[model samples]
Target: MRIMAKTDVFIKARIIKGYSQRELAKKSGLSHAYISLLERSVKSVGPATAKKLSDLLGKELEDLFRIELL
Candidate 1:
């Protein structure tokens, strides 16, 4: 099964909030590299990290990430 990467929504939310990856990292207290990986869909975010990012982005976790199978 292939899992869908919903990082695009995360990216759009960050952009809408006028935050760069570095800025988001600072706000979310996550490393910039990790945020970069998240944006690139190269890494899956954990629940804790997802919560932090969703809070920072002013979005719900459900709106940020969607899981699918293929």
Candidate 2:
């Protein structure tokens, strides 16, 4: 049996909150281009950015960002 890997729910939460990328970025004090990178999983979110997004989107940190162990 195969299991699906857990995915970040950032886009879903952003949609549910009815905010466009630009809007969310402005609200979260980030740039829309950066937000695009985040949504696409092209960039990893740091603790500070995660906290900003979590508080702004009213989502749990784990729900929006994944912590990768090095």
Candidate 3:
């Protein structure tokens, strides 16, 4: 998946779950700056950090990535 798409999904999911970037950062044990960068797609996060976000959002890591329907 493209980094931007992945970031978008992550942010969308967080919003759907009623979390602000600051709240998500707290829950995910990440910095607010890092969370902002991730949500804005300004930085490409490594797998571990991505997994932490996924876990905090109660979503699977695979769901954050864009998947081909075929």
Top-lDDT candidate index: 1
Candidate 2 accuracy as lDDT: 0.75
Candidate that would win on TM-score:
2
* Candidates in descending lDDT order: 1, 2, 3
- Where model 3 places Cα greater than 4 Å from the true spot, the runs are 1-5, 66-70
Instruction: Give the range of the ten consecutive residues with the poorest summed lDDT in model 3.
Output: 1-10
Ranking by TM-score: 2, 1, 3
Evaluated at residue 60, the lDDT of candidate 2 is 77
Candidate 1 clashing pairs? none
Give the per-residue lDDT of model 3 (tens digit) for 1-70. 3333277678789999999989988887889998887777676666677677777788888887544342
Error of 1 at 15 (Å): 0.7
Candidate 1 local distance difference test against the native: 0.79
- Model 2 ranges off by over 4 Å: 1-8
- For candidate 2, lDDT tens digit of each residue in 1-70? 1111123487788888999999998998889998888887777776777888888888877667766666
lDDT of 1 by residue, 1-70 (tens): 3222377798899999999999999988889998888777787776777777888889988888765454
Task: Write down the TM-score of every candidate.
Answer: 0.81, 0.84, 0.74
Candidate 1, position 61, lDDT: 82
